[model samples]
Target: MLRRLALTAVVSLATLSAVTPAATAATGPVPLPLPLPVLQDDARARLTITVSGSEDSAAEGTFELRCAPAGGSHPVAERACDRLDELAGEDEDPFAPVPEDALCTLQFGGPATARITGTWEGRHIDTVFSRTNGCEISRWNNLIPVLPNVR
Candidate 1:
């Protein structure tokens, strides 16, 4: 009986070990895909994101993020300036000069906070103010006038 109990314990331990990691990976430290460029067109548009546990992160590349109108509706990335322009007062040129290589940074342990003072708009705007934790612009979000060739 003891031996059978021991075997059952070992099997349970192995199964738990295998299953635990998959659950963790689902919410593990997701590295930066690229620098997400979020549009900052409002003074009260800054936000903070928090992360838990210990993880390392690095910048991937330049990412352009767009924000929704005042009501926080949220914008979609890569849709097209033709639609975004109407709301932004003017259309952003898809062919604008964005840093081809901007990296995102991990802010803190437990809860990271990402702040911005600009408008982020690509095809779709990332309205979920994530604690992406890297803002290169101060006071006003870095402005890369939407050009007409990047698209």
Candidate 2:
């Protein structure tokens, strides 16, 4: 009787392992969407920035961007991909490895047409980033300081 029970348990475990992949594959990886940054071009627009990663090397995930003051003191702006009606549970969070508060968080989103924009606060943002293999992927620093009609 004990032997029979052990065999049953082993079978159950094996069955579970075998089925899990199929279940996931049956659904397949959800089509991850990208939310681009907000950019306005006008005399009063104040600020504009652009980012890209849509060259095919991007992973599936969200992109949050920050528009803090270049220097002095200022608040930060945040952007998130995926909406309530979109695929959240199935997301892989391409931005996983990087720190949320990382200075480069300023640049994020899809591999293509992933633009972001926000008004500056004061002066001196520690870093600026350019998208890489993925939306959340970033590199380099572009410290921008405020000046008179700097543009």
Candidate 3:
């Protein structure tokens, strides 16, 4: 009876040992596919904004902005990112310059000037903003938190 019990124990141990390796192998780490460069570009957006000549001293400075995963030194990063995304959906170019033939009011908003440089939706962007005239002021105002509120 003792010998039979020992044999049963030995068989059980062998079965467990054999199953353990298979179980571990089944649950082992899985290899992940490499990320596509274009997908990565589409997933991330980064920008640098510099503001000067504004009446508000707090608004004059350089700021960093990131989107898709929204974060940065920009005061309203999430709002700015959302605004950009909304513009994109509407097929609007945020950095487009006012047309030469377009009539603009001679109104002088301010001496405020801003420069934005960065990447958005996989495209490079380098644009300037100023509150010199009505058209330009409207454009600058459209950008809102992204360019900082001059008034």
Candidate 4:
């Protein structure tokens, strides 16, 4: 009986060793792909700026901005690219949404509008900007470096 009990214990230990690894592996965290930054041949963006309404003078023009060896028609390519990078680093989407409950004055900063369409950090970006209210005005101001001289 002693020898039989010893053999049973050994068999049980072997079975446990064989099953433990498979069970642990089945419940382990899944291997997922890392979020990698996009690579591009060139970092370039075409921008359009337009201002409307009588409160502010009207201005409109189109220009290009480039970075990673910053050189483009944009008056401040380096500054603009730096600002863009800062904003992009904050979140996956650079154009962050305005908070709904945030308090803002009713003051109008004119009907300024901006349109950007190009590649950023190897990703295609097509976004619009408008200053119809306080929040929009703040957003437009934040992007002033890249935008045309609409002010």
The candidate scoring highest on lDDT is 3
Per-residue lDDT of candidate 3, residues 113-149 (tens digit): 9999999888889999999999999999999989888
Q: lDDT of each structure?
A: 0.34, 0.33, 0.85, 0.63
Worst 10 residues of 1 by lDDT: 142-151
Per-residue lDDT value at 55 in model 3 = 95
Model 3, C-alpha of 105: deviation from truth (Å): 0.4
Best by TM-score: 3
Q: In terms of TM-score, how similar is model 3 to the real structure?
A: 0.72
TM-score of each: 0.18, 0.18, 0.72, 0.55
The TM-score of candidate 2 is 0.18
Which residue ranges in model 3 land beyond 4 Å of their true spot?
1-43
Tens-digit lDDT string for candidate 4 (1-151): 6566667766776776677777768897444435433432544443333333324332455667777777777667788878777876776465555668988778776656767777776666677777667877777777767764444
- lDDT for 48 in candidate 1 is 19
**RMSD of each candidate?**
20.6, 21.5, 15.5, 17.1
* Candidate 1 Cα misplacement greater than 4 A, ranges: 28-151
In angstroms, the error of model 3 at 97 is 0.8
The window of 10 residues in a row where model 3 has the poorest summed lDDT is: 33-42
TM-score: the better of candidates 2 and 3: 3
Comparing 3 and 4 by TM-score, which wins? 3
